[model samples]
Target chain A: MCLKSVEGIVLVVGDNVDTDAIVPGRYLTLTDTRELGKHALEGLDPSIPGKLKERNLIVAGRNFGCGSSREHAVLALLGAGVKAVVAESFARIFYRNAINRGLLVVEAPGVSQKVSDGDRLVIDLESGVVVLASGETLPFKPIAREVLEIIEAGGLIERLRKELQYGRG
Target chain B: MVNVAMDSLTAKILARASGRDRVEVGETVVATVDKVMIHDVTGPITLDLIDNLNARIPKPESLYIFLDHYSPSPSIPASGIHRRFRIFARTNGVINFFDVGEGVCHQVMVEGIVKPGEVVVGADSHTTTYGALAAFSTGIGSSEAAYAILTGRLWFKVPEPLYVRLDGALPSYASGKDIILSVLGILGQEGANYKALEFAGPGLRTLSMSDRLTVANMSVECGAKNAIFPLDEVTLDYVREFNTPIDLSSLSYLRTAKVESPHLTLDLSTLEPMVAKPHSPANVAPVPSVEGVSIDAAFIGSCTNGRYEDLLAAARILKGRRVSKDVRLIVTPASKRVLMRALQDGLIKMLLDAGAVVTPPSCGACFGGHLGVVGDDEVIISSSNRNFVGRMGSPKAKIYLASPVTVAASALEGCVTDPRRYLG
Candidate 1:
């Protein structure tokens, strides 16, 4: 989790990178999220998942994860050991699903255009800052404090589990 | 009058569900759910997570499960999904299980369980279809659904309302599918991103409840969180199926819950039957412009336009005519009730007699799961909600989205021809 600031290599892609491109629909029936990760980006670039061995941050164009709202895209990215996804904009349902599933995503307008493929950048979720390798810093409107708390707890399910247990106690 | 109704239905519905006097956009509140639906595609994932939590669904009445994605089980893995859904429902005492071939989840939800002004959530994105009947329904992923299943409460951020005003009457051959397709054209791919689409105006009065459902079903194509129409006699009559002899005309909630917006008005009188080309729903074109695009198959079924009326429209064109020799036309109803209704009205016989194979109610053809998947380089004209690359088959296969009328006409011609040519 990128709860605090960390640096990693960035993978750059273009706009409207949809769910089909992330993980093809045929592999969706796999119930386990970890298994879903193996086929990540099989449609667009079959080698992207395996090639993600070193890259932890994905910077892409607008409406990343657009199209049918399946959580498999998020699960696949997580399974591929992706630390975060940054794009100019994201599909509505995918954004919510990413939040609930504890997938770190940053919506930074110029983020994708600024970084080259394999550019190592330092990102801090708490500060909403991305420090580029060129020494230029970009700022983003930070996610709400509550949303950060939920993500820090490893998503809504884990947060609710704690809340429910506390209520029972 | 309609403008005030459009003020914000999301707030009213969420406030009531959360036991708050009012809620504003961006405030996330956990609200009580009227229904929690999971389909064959997303159900197994949700059920598996629930088992880990060691929780049974809190209220069986509010839990709905369906197996419409792969009806009759196309393969062993698909059958495995059905078994998992069945086991979960049986163990949790879920009373709203609709086994394979019953119906698509959206159609079954509206016909059997959804009521006006309730908060409904589902594992599937198209679950936003319930908003047509005045429910605050939205799609949540399987993870959120698992949380809602255990607690009967789901978190919602009240989305801002974007009014899609409709005026004038739909021309001949134009159905609700065209109306929504036109909206998608005007709004583009992400035009309504994160907003709730509120439909209003005199054009709605001339539209049927089925039309409203079709419009609501595809609102997600424009990135809408929910698509809703105001409550009127159309809604009252639809609700009569679940609760009869109930007078809702004087209900204050009806006035507040109905969405209203006058900002973006569309005149249906001038609108043309539309089609979305390959890659995206927003890649729209008029029927005439895209006509004669040769196709190998035509499918008329999906949660988007698969209703009794849609089947009837297709049958009208296929009656007394044969589908082109090379083109295979597959028609699947949205629900068993709709299939039975079509049979009673002789629509099924007309389609079958036209050499159009009318299959059981399922979402197979729409999602490329089974039934009528097209081969690489082959073209298909379909009435399904999406045509994103590889949506119906090989990423190389092209799927064009149109109304049932256009699909039927295209089937008869073996190409993407306009239905107006056949109707006239």
Candidate 2:
């Protein structure tokens, strides 16, 4: 099931946020992910990881996640406690990984300018609404009903488990 | 509003299309895997996962593994990965594994493996490069890649294919790299997000297989799932040279898969040498349009521009000259086979004699992981794809993406300049 949490807002960047930017090639050997998280966005803003520790929502422009299909990008974001990513568009691979891992990624093409850094955001996945502390409400198209169900059921693996259990029991 | 019929190739690739008209912004789709490709960098990991999952290797003949990235490198870990991949393929009875020195995976697969109407998936993003052959291919992660290797199937939401039409013959100095960058300038980085870019028009026929591959390889730069050019006789001739034994009598299968698109044309006769300025891949302009831009490093290679044709082009320019003293030029062949062929033709000696260092075939400077690191405030005009900030090295350094001719010319001048001046 999706969790509704209000984490602080973290504005990293927009437009071609490549995998190399999220987790540089040097850190590829370290599989622990926590260490990889430290370098997330170090290519752009060196202070992102520490700032991310206190933030929840990441706002960005078009093509929020592009480049390599490394899942480490998603893991690093989730590990840093980002509750949702609001972008105008996302790379296909990144979009899929976020859902499979139960990370909330909302599509708000207008969200980039509506919110700024240090702003508080309240995301309600169930309602597909993102509300800024300034009381600005950004309505995003929710994931397909069935996809939401899979995510609500705890991602693909858990959904598969439930399906198997239901079949046998 | 407009009626368009899906072509036979598209129909074959989209047989599993759920008939949904439009994929919403945040929806997840389980797309059919058209083609699955792997290379040395991540194939070993995928092979291990396939063993653990105990999944049947579906269509071993269709699955491809190419050893590119770390060919001839003394890196023990890289060699270990290659060895394990070979053992896995041999033990599993998988048929399509191109060993080191074969060629870059994208080029090898396009030249020998891919066909029209196929949906290809690779562990590398440039897999989209195959779209040039009128096939649909995209990159996937190692885990999801492992799943595909095991099950021979993966899910994808059918992406709405963007229609880009180029109609006129390209000028001699301008090449496919310029066409793609020009397209990127119009589409922007995110303009084609999650969409397949289908390139068609009379002008496409004028471009060679290598040229089309260069265009398709960088489609990912604009956030496209893939960029496709309908397969034709040019593609067949190129593939036949490599895979002589394959019964291509069934080539007619491609015709039946053709998707009908309205004619859209781009006249390239007046196009000039173009460059994608640093910090972003889509930021583009004519090379001569930006004058006096000095370069510290110049690289010529990658799956995109590391083909034999690209090397020959550079060799022609470097034959009787030397790279500028302030500039260090690095030439990497996309594959060991390319290296050997270049050596046989004395392209290697020509490049070295011209003051360029020839390195083994690998991702190398393109990914900024190793080799050809640039210093702060330095700028490089490279034949490889993508010029994003720090793509080749230090974030402080800058990269400009250009054609091999431009890179060669810039290497001689030590600044971004037109290649045509040196040609005459």
Candidate 3:
């Protein structure tokens, strides 16, 4: 369940990336996560996916994902290889979805200003550290211990499986 | 602090939750769920989570499931959700299952399922529409919704209440949609975040159930839990038409819980048709007051304004005329029942003959997820809630919120214009 830590620069955005902007209303029926990934952030900037194929981090303002409670938005970001998302705040649903899928989402209040696009950065969720290529290190309040356990176990389903198995003995 | 009438469902819910203290920004609270509701889109997901949790359903009567979106349009996935919902309802012995053509979820729940002074959680954000009937309703995620179904309890941090008092009678062609948009314009998009909008005063008496529902439906756009109105004979009569042998036991509880005080009032007699301009949900203006704006599309639907009255109003304006060649008009009914009634009354025909494309009763263009999405640089006049940038399709697209008459008129004019001229 361990994921490879991804490193890159940060792209800051404001609150609320609604579903219409995530994949557009036209492609809602498209269940394929891969195809949906290509269109992620296409609403914000059409070039986000092409740039993300190389690797990047998204730093957003408060309430980063605020519209419809669609899991597709998180799936699209994860499928696009978005290593981590640092935002002042995250929508309750989106935050849970990202954690359940083992995606790294950090709440760094001033993180949006500390990093700019193309400023190379490194994120280590395991170490609870974000290292800017500029040699500056920022520490984040780690997720709840139980949540980290679930993320480390790959997701809720996997964590539940392990818990059930342990209980069976 | 001064006292105010606690007649609003929001006030009652808050009063009941006052013991829990405040739920600060970025904090969580878990409270017992008094009731749970779900619609077609989120129902299947919620049921899946419930099954995965392996929790036996409790108090089936308190769980309400409605098939409003995509009713009778039955795509494979939709059909699958419907089938699964039926199986789940029967196996779990749920009593409040309303199938296709029953009515919109929000309307049906308030009229039949939701009781006064109770906490209700639904998977759909518009579930807050039920607050109009003196109940505390809010939207939750599928996982949380599943948790509610499992334990008959969910967590909620107590939210502060925002009091909006309306005093005067509403002007002609001015509806609750305008009132809410006007309020949203005053209060920015997040002005009432995590708060309950307790709507009170004489102005509420001038509005109908449909109108009240419209106001409550859009409360989410402002990030409030719900906009609630006190229950009166108007609400009770509406409910009586749908359910028989009314229970009077709760009436005494409702009366004993009343808190009386002076109200802050908003006079709406001088109000005009309000519109939330595109690029942002909070960018609103009066229809006649705005000018120099053109439109490429016009839509009327969604849980907010897709009711029978909304359609009839649109039809009244659109009958015997055609939409402008440059304008694409799309209309979707909120529920199959509304669609059937519209069809029976020739409202659908009038819309179609007037060049409106009638679609199935799905969420449709409201979320900009599917059906009638505007293109880049396109400007649309819509009756649906929220005009956030890129909410209807392309980020470059613009959405203008207005009444059904305004939207219908705009479709005929190919621009954003006042509907009063054509109506008269």
Candidate 4:
């Protein structure tokens, strides 16, 4: 359950990448996360899904996942095997969705400008530092203990089962 | 000791919901959820999660399910999704299940179910639309929605509100759409990220219920957690129409709560019609600045506009005019209630005479769901919120966000035109 280090090649995108750009409303009918993955980021660029083949991490500028409350956006990213997302910031709803889906999203200011596509990144979830291929280190705010626990438990489903079992006493 | 006095309206609502004396900004609280709404788009997925966890709804009566997105089931898969919602509603003993043609979820929720000071969470993002009624409502993802249904609680980090002061009466041509688009221009898309927009001022008395709803609905375009309008006489009057006995004095305490300093002030008198150009809601310019940008289609619908008042305004401009041959003018009401009222009032007939095609009440084309989707490289003027890439149809298509009146006026000229000229 320990999320100590996640290493992957990074996918770099610019500012204001919204949920609609992540997955359009037209594709929302598909309930399968794997089916959704094929269309991931297709709204932004038709070739984005192809680029996710080798990259497991994304570095984005400010206000990523800015529109819509659809969990499909998180499902799509996860279905595409996106291990983590490092953005300058996230819209509140998308952040909550990623956490509930057990997707690792880090808010690292200046990371988008510092990283390039295909660069390897080793993110230390416990230490809140992102190690770059250039041997540089960028720090990010650590995820809250409660939220990290939910992620470690695989998602909100497990947490809810425990809460329901304990009867909220 | 916490400073319990001088709490903002959002702080007060969160405190009450969480059963705390006071909650500070940045502090997380597990607040009791007052109302929950799920639509066809998210309902099926949420039910799946429920089944996976073997969870039963703690309070089925508090949850409302709507089948408005793919109301008639445009495709087989969509039909299956609607069927799943129906089965789930029946199995859970949910009484507030709204079937197809119920209009949009937000509009129906505002019609009666939402009350001031309650915390409402919906599966759709525009749940912020309820804040026009002074509710602390916001949107959430399906998984979290499932959790809320199972536990009747949701967690929220108290947000520091950006206070806005509005003064002066709106011009004849300008409506809430312009006012909100103007706000988005100043705040940009990310300016209000993770913060609440608390609106209050002398001008609160000037706006109608419909106008306030439009403003609150689009607050999310600027990435606000929620946009709330304090309870006022206008809202009270609207709620009273539905015969909901609401105490005016009991809610007056919220009006007295101390709000922070004004973050942005807008004079409705000086405000002109505004439009958000394609690719972003923050890419806004005045109607005059973008005038003469030819359009292939014009739409008046979605949760943003499409109210009865919105249609009446557009009908006034379109009563004698015919839609330009170059444009396809489509009008979809926000809900069946709105559509029925428009039909009974002759607004629908007037729109038809003007060559506008009126469709049933659905989300329709605003999110590119169905009907009136544009072609590649085409341009459209929409009364709906969000002009993000590929929002209406093709990613290459340009969408302009504007008032219903502007969409109507643009339908006549087949280009982006100001509503002011037609108002007279």
Candidate 5:
């Protein structure tokens, strides 16, 4: 079943927030999502993880997740209860990693400018629009259908399992 | 009316992989992958996913596994993971498993495995390095890698190619590292986001294969999906040396394909040594401008710039010279092959004589994983790519990215010095 929507309070961050900032390299050995969550954004600001407890949405500027192909960054966010990341843009690998891991990453330009920390956001995966607390709606480019299928299946591993069982993957 | 379809090498490669005559930009295609790679860091995750999904790889020979990162088991946990990898490889009958000290996956792949016009995916972003060999390569996440390994295929959105035309040979003071850093400076941190950087023009004749590899290795640093050089004598010469058999007729597309227009035309002769200042690969500047900035450490190695050519360049600068008393110099070869070649060439001896600590071939301290991790408030000048915050250790520590020659010069001066001063 496809996820229709996600609504949550957001934590805002600035531009060029890299993967090293999302999950430091030291804790990469900890692959468990929950364990990785404890250190989300540790390099950027230690207090960010504390804020994530209350806000499960992230509003960010351009080039979020800009370094390394470590899936730990996406796992860290998932572990921290981050339901979706609405950024102006994302580094390509991080964008792919997020989708492959079933993380909702919408690239809605200017979404970062209108949204502030703690503001509530409603992301409708179907319409590819983000509904903000101020009632302003921002439309993001719809993700590719192939990518959506992966996300709908709750990640690549799950999707692959189903595909293999069906012998049509 | 022109009937011929003018496609960049990126499009042609993707088209071929997808079993189509041509593919459009932004179109997603389920393409067969010619090669797949995973490192110690991402390898374990892939294995775990494979186990959970109960999937068996149909063709294990296409998969390459390397124990490069946290290599030789940096800790008990790392060793345990490495042990699991060995067992998994043996049980699965995968023959291309590279043991610890073999070298980085990217280095080893290009040494003899990856071929032009092939689609390669690796769990590490530097997999873009294979593009130097005329292959279409990009990095993927662990889960994606697992899926690719099981199916021998993955989907790729054909990226728009950004043509970079080079016009002249690089000045003696500059290397491919400088060329890439300068390009990154022009194209900022995200300038080429999701775009393919295609290299061509007469200047392509000037760069050695090692130089091309260094330039392509850091494509991801500027948000490029992949960076490719055309198949020329330089690439052919290198591949021939390794005895990689290939069908030359099929590779004509690489040499003949052209983009509509060049996005950036660079005169390599005008270039000089460059550095990416503290914290960002795109935060680049000429080496002369950043000269005199003190450094606590200087390192020359990693998949980015740790080849035999890079080592020899550094050795030339360090010969008959002692490293500054205040600066600790660390040299890690990219692979065991590179290490062996360097040792035979006496580059290792020159570095050791210059008071540098030579670590075994591994992705040591490049990602701050194990050896050579910098401390708080420390400043390091490295030849490896990516100087992101805390990348080489403490978040408080700063990293300056440069070529190996610049690294050697800086180690001797205990500061960021112009490599040109010693190059001639």
Candidate 6:
């Protein structure tokens, strides 16, 4: 289902938070989702995954999820209970993977600059707004229509399943 | 003036793949993939999703499953994936199931099967490597690959094209690794985001098939969706050498092919041996600039630099010299085919005589799987693409990306050193 808004504390990170750093190659063989989550971002900080509580969000710099076309990186983040990722921009493959998996990835050009680590923010996917505790709001491009439909269907797996059931997309 | 009407080679390839006269940038098209590949790392997960779809693939002949990464069965997981992939391929009638040690997915494609004017996609991002053959190839995630497996098609947003023209012949000491690292340096890591890098120019003749593949393989480092070289006599001869009894002379697209406008030219001859310092591929510099930087290990393999010529380059430097006692050297041929050829040519014996460990035909140590994993406090010089943190071993270990020549040279000295003196 498409979440109209997400309210959570942000775990801020720098630019080019690539896939290998998100989920390093050594542990890539462990295809289990929960195990991958426990080791997520171990390259950057081994403790990051444990810090991610339910509905927590990640606010990162430009080109988040850069490098590697592996969906394991996205799965790791989602498996750790990350509600959404708001970055200046995203690597194309990661963006598509996130959308297909029904994960919320927002591109807010100055989102990182506006929020510090531990800042509670309310992000509206439908309207593309990020509201900080101080009442400051950042505008972003709203989720695309077709992508919203995928999110509404609980991801591409469900969407594809529906298509197969009905005999069309 | 903006050439809004200029369609890229990527566009043309898409147009042909989709059965249309033309496809433009930003248009979504259902591209018919000429071939697709999935390795051990991602293939099992893709299989799970494919099982969900429960769609019997019609053209099983076009799909290729490679068991390269962690091959030789590093652990039970890798072995299980291998077994599953074997069963899946056999049951589905897929002919190109490359078993353990066959080679990397990219090298396997280059050895044969991949052709010009084709659209290829693989689960691995380095799938862009096949574009060296003038095919429009890009990397996609396993979800997309799963969809492609169910059907013979996948949708793509025809990316904007970035033309990178090479000028002047590179010095013999400088290999394709230097050329590509220099390109990555100039374009940072994300300069070509969501774009296709089309390589076309007179200087293209200076590179070998492996060299073109080397440059094309790392196109994803700059965030390009695809990278391609136009079909010429060099590529034609290379392709024909493997796919015998097929007439390449009858192909029309090879003769009239050309990339569109909006491009930049790079002078190849001026480039020196280069390296990308940790923890990203874009942080590139000349070898001399980073000279004397110590290393704990030297790796000479990956889809980017594990061809016969790459091993030959390293063999030239280590013919009689022993690797530094403090340094460990690991060489992995891109494929079992390359390893066998190198063995017949005595490259493997020479490396072993010099105290280097030669692993099986697999993607090892490049992404820190096994064989020569660096320590937390160590530094490494590798011919593999990508030097991201924790890419090789510990996140604390630094990786320096270089050509096989530099890797061999540095392996002997245990530090980053100029390769000119080692070159013949």
TM-score of each: 0.95, 0.89, 0.81, 0.98, 0.98, 0.96
Which 10-residue window in model 2 chain B sums to the lowest lDDT? B2-11
Given candidate 1, what's the lDDT at residue B171?
83
Runs in model 2 with CA error above 4 Å?
A2-9, A149-153, A156-169, B1-12, B16-34, B40-62, B70-102, B244-253, B256-264
Query: What tens-digit string does per-residue lDDT give for candidate 5 at B1-424?
Result: 5323478788889999999888888999889998899988877778879998877789999889999888777898888888888999999988999999998788889898999889999999898999998899999999889989999999999999888998888787778998899899999999999999988887878898988999999888899999998888888999899999999998988886463368898899899889999878999998988999999999899999999999999999999999999999999898888999999988889899999999998898889987799999999999999898899899999999999999999999999999888976
Ranking by DockQ: 4, 5, 6, 1, 2, 3
Against the native chain B, what TM-score does each candidate's chain B reach? 0.96, 0.87, 0.86, 0.97, 0.98, 0.96
Q: Name the fnat for model 4.
A: 0.87
Error of 2 at B74 (Å): 7.0
| Docking quality class, candidate 1 | medium
Q: What local lDDT score does residue A148 receive in model 3, on the 0 to 100 scale?
A: 70
Candidate 4 versus the native: TM-score? 0.98
lDDT of 1 at A136: 91
Best-to-worst order by lDDT is 5, 4, 6, 1, 2, 3
Worst 10 residues of 2 chain A by lDDT: A160-169
Determine which window of 10 residues in candidate 3 chain B has minimal summed lDDT: B255-264
Cα deviation at B261, candidate 5, in Å, is: 3.0
The complex in candidate 6 yields a DockQ of 0.74
State the DockQ of every prediction: 0.66, 0.45, 0.26, 0.86, 0.84, 0.74
How much lDDT does candidate 4 score? 0.89
lDDT of 6 by residue, B328-399 (tens): 999999998899999999999999999999999888888788777888889999999988988888888999
Fraction of native contacts, model 3:
0.15
Colliding residue pairs in candidate 5: none
Model 3 iRMS (Å) reads: 3.5
Docking class of 5: high
